[model samples]
Target chain A: MAAAALREQLNALLSSMFASGLVDDQFQQLQMLQDDGGTPGFVAEVVTLFCDDADRIISELAALLEQPVVDFDKVDAYVHQLKGSSASVGAQKVKFTCMQFRQLCQDKNRDGCIMALAVVRNEFYDLRNKFQNMLQLEQQIQAQQ
Target chain B: MAGAASAAAERKVTIRVLLVEDEEIHRVLARALMKAVGGVELDEAGNGAEAVRRVREGGAYDLILADRQMPVMDGHEATRQIRALGVTTPIVGLSSDSLAADVDAFIKAGADDFTPKPLSKEKLNHILAKFNLA
Candidate 1:
């Protein structure tokens, strides 16, 4: 039997994820994958990939912004890709931030891009921590079982 | 540990959970919660259509926890479809925005209960108990 304490922890994590709007329906898709014999590791894998992609995109975006004559089109492309991936994974906050970032890019506001980058980075770090904590909890549960 | 195990064994009853969701994160969290709750075997589908398919193919489920909105088919359509198929699995609509109107709509579409997002232990337990599953 699974321990109630562990269940409580998982529930708390989920509640926070929802309340914070860090996750959405896409998280549910990850859970379904687990029920289908996709281990928690599968979720970690997908999320790690997302994190990697986000990091790369953010770097590229920063580089674009550093240019003497910022290429709004290139920056917009990166934002678009980030938004799509964030949306796919149900990272509601990140996706929303990316949307704002895209708008700022269209407006050619270097200052806006810089501010949005901070928001995006903060959100990314927060989500990463949350996901990592959840994964740790899952590992703990598995260990207890 | 021994006492807890004995107590659990005495009250052990498998919970057949029908998970209706379109996202991966919520699905993972829900599964973890279900497992932690003990006595749960979860069945899942990405959207309403797949959920209905699983129900039709897998037979009756003890409970259904479905998301409000999804692609290909929404929760309401899935619930309606399941009811149309004559499957009486108790469905609880899960949504971040569980407005009264939304709850009413889900109920009208054939949901037996409603649990809003972030999914608190109290809320989930309450819904499960309503269906005599907890």
Candidate 2:
């Protein structure tokens, strides 16, 4: 596909994602921060970091929660980290999930938190896929340029 | 110590800033943000305790931007400690948790202001101008 076509496709995809509530204004804010003088792709770089961080946190949560005697403090700490990362990238859906998950942690509701953890993990994966697709489109656009 | 800081302030055209953040990435981001504003001489501390120590060994810092959450000591306790050390430099919280209660905690502990991440040029500049650091 040509550069213009790719750019348009990327734009549409982003717009639809926003409309569908997959991301929020923070993502647009990230885009604006990308033009760091001669440097480019700051948004993609940071989002990629968020993805990696999310994956590690998700696995940690899985293992931690699987223990018979769950340590709620550790659970909350991981959830808090996820919330910050998601908020940093404007991963609104994931952040929302994390907020609820953290509250469950505070309540010490093992069953409730377990449920919230699964939901948060799913949201993280979904957001990661969206971010990956967006980054790929971004790279193709830069290559064409 | 005060006289030394005053002398340093008189000798420089640039605004001196002490940036306190544990994460290397955030420290880099903070440095980049300061560079964007121009006329800034920036220093960094890895965490809250280090930041307090730097303040104790005083120099003229126009502003201190500390990550509100950190190991060893948090920005809140650091702020309280810095204030206790008789350092009057303006301190701002680099807060990720922006809840009213959390923000209030920083303010109660002696932070003059806050700028949330990922850092914004507009918000930071506004805060700088408010304190005459700009």
Candidate 3:
């Protein structure tokens, strides 16, 4: 496909992401920072890092909750880490889910935490899929150049 | 946009910054953000303890940006430790927790100010201006 058309499609996808609250201005701020030079693909790099971080933290949370005696403090800490990473990359939905998950952890509600973890994992996967699409478009744009 | 970038360019002072963040991705983002601002020399410390050690060994940083929550030692304790060492460079606390108590705790621990996490260009510049680094 032509670079301009690919660019427009990418823009439209990004716009829809914002409209759907899948991402926020922090993501745009990251893109702007990338445009200012130094790191050519800063946003994509951060997003990839975020995905890895999220995967580890989510798995940790799941395992912790699976133990006979769940450690609420440990659960809360992992959720906090996930929330921070999500906010850094402007993954709005995942960050929000992490917030709720943290509250459940704080309350020491084992059942609530399990439910929240499932929800947050789903949110993370959804955002990750969108990010993969965005990254693919970015690569195509670069190839055309 | 263009105006902000130009203004940052006009500052022309290479402010040396020690950024204390546990997460590598955040450190990477900070590096890019500072580069956008155009004249910043950034150093990294994984946690508060490392930050304190760096300052004690005479890092000569113009500013310190400490993330409030870290594994080894949090920003609050690090700020207190750095202050105990008599290093009086500006310490700005960063956190995703915007709670008033958190901000107050950081200031009480000797941080000069507090800013919410995921630092944007404007916030970075604001910190510089507030500390006279700009």
Highest DockQ against the true fold, candidate: 3
On the 0 to 100 scale, the lDDT of residue A143 in model 2 is 90
Top model number, TM-score: 3
Output the lDDT of residue B36, model 2. Answer: 53
lDDT of 1 by residue, B75-98 (tens): 999999999988887888876555
Q: How close is candidate 2 to the true structure, as a TM-score?
A: 0.85
What tier of docking accuracy does candidate 3 attain? medium
Model 2: lDDT of residue B57: 86
lDDT of 1: 0.77
The DockQ of predicted model 1 stands at 0.03
- Which pairs clash inside model 2? none
CA lDDT scores, all candidates in order: 0.77, 0.79, 0.90
Candidate 3, residues A36-144: lDDT per residue as tens digits?
5746888889999999999999999999999999999999988988988999999999999988888888899999999999999998898888899999999999999
DockQ ranking from best candidate downward? 3, 2, 1
Q: Which stretches of candidate 1 lie over 4 Å from their true place?
A: A1-122, A125-145, B1-10
Candidate 2 local Cα displacement, residue A83, angstroms: 1.3
Candidate 3, residues B29-107, lDDT tens digits: the string is 8988877776788999999999999999889999999998898999999999999998889999998888899899999
Displacement of the residue B100 alpha carbon in candidate 1, Å: 2.2
